[model samples]
Target: MSFAPYNDLRRHCAALGFGNQWTEAACALGNERFAACPHGDYPRWKAALDGLPAVPPAFRMREGMPCLGEDFQDQQGLADELMTFHPWRKGPLQLAGVTIDTEWRSDWKWSRIAPHIDLSAQRVLDIGCGNGYFGWRMLDAGAELVIGVDPTWVFVMQWLACRHFAGDLANFVLPQGIEDLPEQEVAFDSVFSMGVLYHRRDPAHHLARLHSLLKPGGTLVLETLVLPDDQADGVLVPEGRYARMRNVWAVPGCERLLRWVAEAGFSNAQIVDVNQTTVEEQRSTPWMTFESLDKTLDPQDSARTIEGHPAPRRAVLIARSA
Candidate 1:
């Protein structure tokens, strides 16, 4: 499905003189047909539209106009930058060294338990390892071998980073989902999955697939959004983004997730930690332009709230395989 906002962005760019060139470039990049923009006149072309009223000034135009720059280049740049300086970017994973305060690490309190897990010898698998930041951590933590799986073309960054840091790209595999992970028939001793379960339409199926990938006594680390006590079957935060079967399958409670893990043959499970406070403290960065912020924060927009609250909170879960 096309992200509506991005489609709107394409239209906005077209209105500002970035027409067929931008659209065709974006399509080609989206289809993975080209690496960097073949026509390299992106910055000059984008500069030509610098004063256009239709384009959002906040839009960073550089090297390969709306296409590679916006569509792929920026993301790749961010991934490359993140990989280069990751906390575990160098030596053995130091639990206390990770300082980036992204939403993923907000509730992360693994430092206290780091000493208990034998990361150095365990076979660790990181599912949905976007940019492989955490995967790098696993390696530093002493994991003998760290395998990261991500389906996006963004994996190119992970592949490059692995070649540089780990000395091999074989450790980082690309699989659309757990179901497609058979290429690595070697069962893992521990699996780390974060910020992924909630996005699945069939979370239970995903869990089952994960279970199948593990050897006996494997550990599965999970983190996801959960509904409040009063709300069962998940809550509808904003109109189009509800917790439904075809869409995201938000667990109503730890009990719901535990049930799925148990059905997948996991014998033990529990909420190792809950960060409702962290979620409450979170806030989106304000847009530089008032118009952009207004469109997102407008009171009339049903798509901006959770039962009327500004944003919904998420819950994290950690479970073990039977």
Candidate 2:
């Protein structure tokens, strides 16, 4: 809710020796998008941010958990204030003293990814980076800086919660989507598009956007819902909804996924890790009260969603920009 975040980000970009014009444009976009934020809950979220204790900013990523600050005015009150940003989708973060068990055990996904990509000293971009959780993980993996974007305002609020404890850290989250970013070819050293491809109406266009964001031969870390090879011919275009998620436009088979990336000007597209989503990995917790994977799948069959579609299976593919 404050311009301080953008200011810190701009200064960090400058310190990293990024192009002045691009950094300025990015800061402007961040300010503009935040100014016109349409989320009705913005006021309450801002108040929650304002309500946080005036603790010294300190951040450390310990064992995949972003630990922020060491002291709090009131632990219970701090927890209550954080609860205002409910339905926390990504975390298990350590905020001051309060531990937030988020909906997704996102660290598990990161474990599957960290082994495949080399992010040491890389300038990275993360699309749909909920509350910048992976940004910390990426930072720990040795990325010099991580610019994360997510459309959801609550996630931005959550990032602020972490930022409240992180003084001028290189990890930043802008309240914008990947499409909203300025088109800068050869911009980042690595680009991550996770849990996002299936939601795009045109996955090819999405891939192109990702390609344009990275430098030639820059690493591309893409994680998305993928169907088994035998399940669909090429891509599965769900008739109604997939796993009660209406936005899922297409779930491609592993082979078609490679083809899409190949046609999008990416080279050496390879499936690095593929794992079926489990209820234990994603379920409602005290911090996220809504129903999750447990209720999304069929009670009768573990391998099928309640909608009778194949159960959720995700894949992490590593590619290089051509």
Candidate 3:
């Protein structure tokens, strides 16, 4: 793994005068964890990046969100190289002339949450930020810096490959999780935990940790799978899997989640939006060749999962640390 980018990040933090425990911990974690993890695809991804044709030092969020191709290189070859890192879950990234139509239209989710937040000049932390796709959008929206953390090494490689094309900036994704974050680091202006809460076996504990990571009065943006209004008082602990995802632990109602937020000591917790995920939002594409939302839902009834649980509905909630 290249520690050059991590070194650059350290320099960037120093230039910004951000000498906090979070910065120190992040730099340490990035250096240690990323170098130690020996993912099977790491070398391949690195080789692809090394072989990538040089592009102009420019990237913009126009056309679609966070696109590359200003310098324009071997279009088909670059696309083929990018395909080696398959099963793309987050974005619809456009290379020089090829468009990687990813499984999830993440831009829609961003649209739902972006209008409600004040991101300009904020130092943000995005948990479970797959490939740092949203981090680029956050930077484009005027955020000062975005610290994205995810434990998946494959996703980290994908983000690195993307960074090769997008050029260096303030966005940095550490190959770590929320648990890897240092406790008592209250430096961020905002923290986002999208599609992460339900995966937690202990939602309250997770919420408390999120609260602890933020400064007093810092904003928290949380998005997660949810139950509908009828099940507002109930929390669905799936017997096995929900929507073919084995990690799903708790699917709570919006009100129940708000209560969890309040119990975690966040103020003014409210649900901003609720949208049922459709095939249009999440489906199989060439870039991501796997069973998707369509296959996860009941063929007989789209309103239920294959396991006979409620269909997938996601909610966005915003709160402030007290």
Output the worst ten-in-a-row residue range by lDDT, candidate 2: 178-187
What is the alpha-carbon lDDT of model 1 when measured against the actual structure?
0.46
Q: What tens digits encode model 2's per-residue C-alpha lDDT throughout 1-322?
A: 4544688888888888975666677778888877777889988888888778888877777777888888686889889889998978897798887888999999999999898888899999899998999998888789999999898889988998898876668998988887788754347899999999998999999999999888887989999998876853478889998998999999998888999999999999999999999999999999999889989899999899999888999999999997
Per-residue lDDT tens digits of candidate 1, residues 39-109? 44433422322322221112211121111111222433334343333222111211112123332332133
Error in Å for residue 274 of model 3: 0.4
Report per-prediction Cα RMSD to one decimal: 14.8, 1.5, 1.4
Task: Tell me the deviation in Å of residue 246 in model 1.
Answer: 10
Segments of candidate 3 deviating more than 4 angstroms: 1-4
TM-score of 2: 0.96
Candidate 1: give the clashing pairs: 93-140, 120-142
| Best-performing candidate as measured by lDDT | 2
Deviation of model 2 at 166, angstroms: 1.7
Order by lDDT, highest first: 2, 3, 1
